[model samples]
Target: MIGRLNHVAIAVPDLNSAMAMYRETLGADVAEPFDQPEHGVTVVFITLPNTKIELIHPLGDDSPINNFLAKNPDGGIHHMCYEVGDIIAARDQLIANGARVLGNGEPKIGAHGKPVLFLHPKDFNGTLIELEQV
Candidate 1:
C-alpha cells in the first residue's frame, strides 16, 4: 500500500528559468523537456537518489498546472508521488481509506511511461499525492 517517494512535482511559471535553476544552479542533470498533451503540461524531469523532481508549467489556462501556479505564484510543491507495485490495487486501498480520486478511475501514462493517478488534495490536507507504478 505504500512505498518510497518517487518524485515531487513543482509548478513553475516559466519552464526555461525553472530548468536552468534546477539543472545549472542546483546541478541536477535533467532530461530534456517533454510536452504532455494529455495533461496539458510541458515538463522537465530531474532524477534524484531517492526521488525525482518535475518542473512543470501549464500549456494553457485549462491546464491543471495553471490553476496551481495561480494560487502558488512562488512555484511551491504541487504533488508528492509514491511508487506502488500495482496502481489499481493501491488506488482501491486508498479509496477505501476515504481518499478521493481526481482523475478517471484508471491509471494514466506519466513521466517515463510510468502509470500514475492523482488523489484529491482535499483528502490530504491540500497536498495532492500521486501513485505511480514503475
Candidate 2:
C-alpha cells in the first residue's frame, strides 16, 4: 500500500526558469539539476518542509516530457509519488485489484535512486501515480 507523499513532479518548459522561481523568488532550497538520461529527464528537487517538489524538463526529443509540454506549453503537474514499504508486494496487490502498471510493469530506479513503478492515470482518477519503495 501507499505510504507518505514522496514528491510531486512538475514538467516545465524551461528548467532554469523553474529553478529560479523556486530558488530565487520563492527562496526555497533547491538541489542542483540532475540529468536522468534513463528516464529522459533533467530534474531538480525543491525541498519543502514536509515533502518535495520535483521540477523536470525533457532531456531529449523522445522524452515523455516533450509530449507533455507539447500538449501544455506552460507545463504543469506531471505525477505524484507515494512511498511504499514493499514495492513488489504493493505492485502485485495493485495488479490483482485491476490497476494497470505503466511501461513493462517492473520497477525502475527513480530520481531518488529508489525502486519505483508508475500506475496508469486512468486507474487513479486521471492523475498519474508513482509508487516508490521506502
Candidate 3:
C-alpha cells in the first residue's frame, strides 16, 4: 500500500552546514529550514527530479534527532518515506500483517502537512520507514 518514494530523511548535526553543502556545493534546489515543533526538528528539503531529500536537525535536547546524532556524530540516513493512497487503510494492513507501528500507532502531520506514520525499523530491514498519505 505504499506509493512513490516521498523522501529520504537524513539527520545532521549542523543544519546550516548541511544546507550550504546542498545549496552551494551541490547546487541543489533546497527549501528554507522549517521548524516543526511537534516533530522536534528543523528540516529543509533538497529537491530532486524524482524525489526529495529531507535534512533534519534536532530542535531541542529531547528531540529524537538529537539521540540519533548522539549515536552517530557524523549523522546519516534517519528514515525513508513512502506515499500511500489512504493512510488509515495502509496502517490497518500493516498492523494486520504483524508489522509494528511506532508512536502509539497513529498518524501525525508530516512536513508536507500530510498524514504520516512510522513503522518499526526492525520490521523493515533495520531501516525506519515512514508512510505518508498522498
User: What is the C-alpha lDDT profile of model 2 across 4-118, one tens digit per residue?
Assistant: 9999999999888999899999999999998999999999999999999999999977897888899999999999999999999999999999999999999999998999999
Local accuracy of candidate 3 as per-residue lDDT tens digits, 64-133: 8887898999999999999999999999999999999999988999999999999999999999999999
Q: Estimate each model's TM-score.
A: 0.91, 0.97, 0.97
lDDT of 2: 0.94
Q: What is the C-alpha RMSD of each candidate to the true structure, in Å?
A: 1.4, 0.8, 0.8
Top candidate by lDDT: 2
Model 1 clashing residue pairs (backbone): none
Task: Report lDDT (CA) for all predictions.
Answer: 0.85, 0.94, 0.94
Predict model 3's lDDT versus the native: 0.94
Runs off by more than 4 Å, candidate 1: none
Task: List candidate 3 segments past 4 Å from native.
Answer: none
For model 1, residues 1-134, the per-residue Cα lDDT tens digits are 76888888888887888888888999998888888888888988888876789888887668987777878887888899988999888988988988899867789998768889888989989899988896
